[model samples]
Target chain A: MGNDVSFFSNVLYMASNVQMIIAVLLGALGGVFVGFLPAFGSPTAVALLLPLTFLMPTDVSMVMLAGIYFGANFGGAIPAILVNTPGTPPAFITAIDGYPLAVKGKAKEALFVSNFSSFVGCILGAVMFYFLANVVGKAALAFGPAETFALMVLGLACVAGLSKGSIWRSIIALAFGVAITTIGIDPLTTVPRYTFGKIGLYSGIPFVPAMIGLFGISEAILLLQKGKMFEGDKVEEEKALNTKANGPTLLERAKMLPTNIISSIVGFVVGSIPGAGATVAGMMSWNLARQRSKTPEKFGKGAIEGVAASESANNAASAGALVPMLSLGIPGSSTTAVMLAALMMHDILPGPLLIVEQPGLISYLTASYIIGGLAAFIVFQLSIPLFEKLMYIAKPIIAGLVFVLAVSGTYFLRNSLTDIYIVALFGIIGYLMKHFDFPVAPTVLGLVLGGGLESNLRLALKIGGVGELFTPIASFCLLLALIMLVLPTIRSRRTRNEESQVM
Target chain B: MNRIVGLLIVIVSLAYTIGALKWSLWTEGNPGPGLFPVIIGIIALIAGVMCIVEGVIPVNGKQTLIQGLKWSAFLVALTVLVVFLMEFLGIAIGSGLAFAAVLTAGGYRRKFLLILIPIITTVSIYLVFGWWLHLPYVWIQ
Candidate 1:
């Protein structure tokens, strides 16, 4: 109890700092702006801003970035609910129910619920960060090279699980990613592996350029092929689409409280695990809610419960991602991975000694999230009508705008044309992969985890001796990967046999 | 398309593994540079082989590999074009062109879309990176 009070007071003191306050407001504003824009998102935003952090105080810069990180999640829900276009990846699930609600003239209700759920999730996550910081930090300290390697393998294996298509294809993508990671200098020997005599390849594949190519450029191509799938102008024609005019009544809002609470818990738990983020949480929650609901058929048709479940889970996942990042230095999602990078840039090592080293920093970071969430909720609610109006704009204009932003953002990273080329190259790769039902996310996951896995594996082998490669931790991770790889094959065969029988 | 992709990956992996084996798989005092790459190459080779086999042998009425290739060409073209442009024009200009081209190709017919999207996107990015944030612009020069 005494510790809690001390932590609370420390947070208050940190928040009172004029510099920290300014940082929070700036980050929150940046987050909202990026979140509202379809092309701009947290990772790109961070990459664009990475250079600037070199000039500012590490703590202030990190706090500001963290604020933007959470703020984006909060702001992302607006476009998703009103326009059916997810401004960020986490909001993809939100569009499932949110767009339907908007189509049904329940846009205001969707907006309200989204904001409310976001606020609830942020607060819950902040509380967890504050109370459990010490415990998590200590646990993180115990993780060594072997455990880290295992964790990476587990993360890569998840690609098979999360992929919508054949697991075999996903594994192929994952392996491709791992292979790409080996293109630069060898971690142990410092000798070049697949650089092909190129100086640029010495550093391995640059993350920002590769990511821009993978997510940003690829998406543009896909969207272009589909030809303005989001025609917001059609919304104006539907007089029944004005959700604000016929908002949910107070009693109805009250009834959703229980659903929101349950979904938030589900989001938080799933989010705290490394690799799983809002997408998984949202899908899981929505599925559970549908299973529990009396009318499961209403799920795809704009059910209020669906909106609540998805929104709550996604928002909670945003908060939950912080858990592993703060405790173990392992990012729970891509966005958090960027955040971890930001922290590293600031020289703030996020591990066991983090709290002891900077007592008030954890408290302040937690408080900043709370404040950011509240601010985002208020700002998002107030701008609902305006955003709804923006959705009526033509699709061509939106696509054009998004493409430009994505390109420019990629250019900003390291100011190199090489990066731009990488983006373009990946964009094509991303597009082709999609056309052939080759999943892009696994590639991204592979890119993100590939370097880490290889480096750690080498380091662990060096430290533990060649014989130690078969240690419990390494063996365990390998076993898990084998299971992940084999299980899908078994499942697919069984399903095929069953279908043949039915035929 | 699947078969080509698989074949390309397999060939690349096999070539890289052979190169790595020649360079150094293991040394007496320290681990060789080729060790990790060799492992990754082997994995890639195996996966590529599996993918190719799957492409060759259909499981449940999936599209033929050649059918997949036709659809993938446009994307590959777009990628190659962007990469070439990025080197000559720089990131901002190259990206703006790519964006405009892709969006236009995507069926965005409005004249305003082409003009406004590029201008707004370029200017806003300039402000964020060049003016407000003052990040060093490497691609432009």
Candidate 2:
């Protein structure tokens, strides 16, 4: 109870911190700006912004990142509503009802519905996060080295197996990631492993530069190849945002409060599971809302509730996905995985002890979500026209800009040309992997978790030999990993067999 | 293409596995640094072989051209040259050159965008990273 009071006081303290508040607000605005562009998701935004946070205080940087993380959810729905272009995969569901409304000249009502629902979803998710994260943290305190190893395995397996690509390709990506982790000095031993006698490789490939390269530069290359960014007609903003249109009023949109609540709950649950990210959460919640709606026929045809359902759920899931990262040091989504990597870079270890060690972080993060959501709502509300204009910038120009940023940002990491070279290498590797339909998230997660996985395995072995892996918690986690890995193959086989039977 | 990528992966993993063997697989009855790499290598090798097998199966779509490869290669080479000439050329000029080249290659024939946007972006980078974050890069002196 005393701890509760202290936590709230810290939250109040963070709310008062001018720098942190400004950081959060700036991050929110930046997130919204990035979300306006297609194919630039939260992971890319966070990765690009990471180099800037190197000099900041850990709490401030984290809050800023948290702000961006949630703010993007709000921003993502705008493009979906206006242009039928989902800025992020999760927002694809939003486009179903949103774009139809735009076509029907009710884009204003749809935008309001999306904005309000996203804000409410963020609040609900933050509330749930405040309670559930602590519970998960307490439970995770029981995890030993063996359990940790098993958990990391589960993390790797979940990413590789659950990816949209073939499991073999995903595993190949994972293996490649793990291989990258093996470069430089071995964590367990003092011996050099894959450095190839380079003097600068003593610390291994820097995570920030490599990430910047993989996500930033590779994406730029792809954008270059694509030529154009937006294909739908120019988002006739005046027509879209006409205030006097015979569209649903504020009160009518408010009627979606119940749908928002139920969908947020669904989203929160789905997001708490690793590898089932906001895209899945948004889809699940939107479908459930459709099933339960009184006016089911209105779905996918400009139902304001549909927009509310997807936007709310995906936003909530963004918050929910932080539970595992904060509590167990295992990221619940790819964005949080990048966040986790950034946290580790600052030497701020996350896990069961993190909450106890820095109880203020949760409060600050919670406050960030509230403020960031409100800020995003306000920004989107007033500046819809501004974002519309931003969408007009050519993709090639954006690609060029990203290219320069990627080069310079990477150079700023260690102020070394070698880091730049490493980034270029990884950029090519990332591009190739993308070309081959291999998932990249697993590789990032694998690299981030690789050292921990190795160190934990060594520690667990020293403590209890090979038999330690069969301990209840360890075995349970391993079983979960195995199940995740095998389920996809089985499901695909079944799908193939059913298709053949149909033929 | 898939077969070549798979074969490359196989060779790399095989070499990696061999390289890992140079280190002690175990020390004091515990798994050593090499053991994990060996395991990872084997997994990669298996996945590579699987990839090779999967490649044999026919697919529907025609293989697409590696469009924009020339531009992509030019961008990479320009970036390398920029880095190499950082002391002489500085960030702003190098970035502008790279940006203009890419924009031109991407079919932006508009002289205004090709010229103006690069300057704007270069300045923005300077203001954001150089001024705000104080990134100690060699800029136009």
Off by over 4 Å in 1: A1-26, A35-40, A43-66, A73-121, A228-354, A357-361, A380-395, A465-482, B1-6, B29-31, B56-109, B112-114, B135-141
lDDT score of residue B55 within candidate 1: 71
Q: How high is the TM-score of chain A in model 1?
A: 0.71
- For each candidate, what's the DockQ? 0.33, 0.49
Instruction: State each model's C-alpha RMSD to the native.
Output: 6.5, 7.4
Best by TM-score: 1
- Our model 2 lands, by Cα RMSD against the true structure, at 7.4
Best by lDDT: 2
Q: Give one digit per residue, the lDDT tens place, for model 1 in A127-227.
A: 77677666644554455666667766765664554444356677667777677777877766677877879998898777556655565555555444443
Q: Write the per-residue lDDT of candidate 2 for residues A320-356, one digit (tens) a residue.
A: 8787788788786768888889878978787878888
- Where's the lowest-lDDT run of ten residues in candidate 2 chain A? A229-238
Query: Residue by residue across B1-141, what tens digits does model 2's lDDT show?
Result: 557777988999999999999998888887887888999999989988988887732222222225535445766787788786676666766777778878887778888777788788678767766776566664765
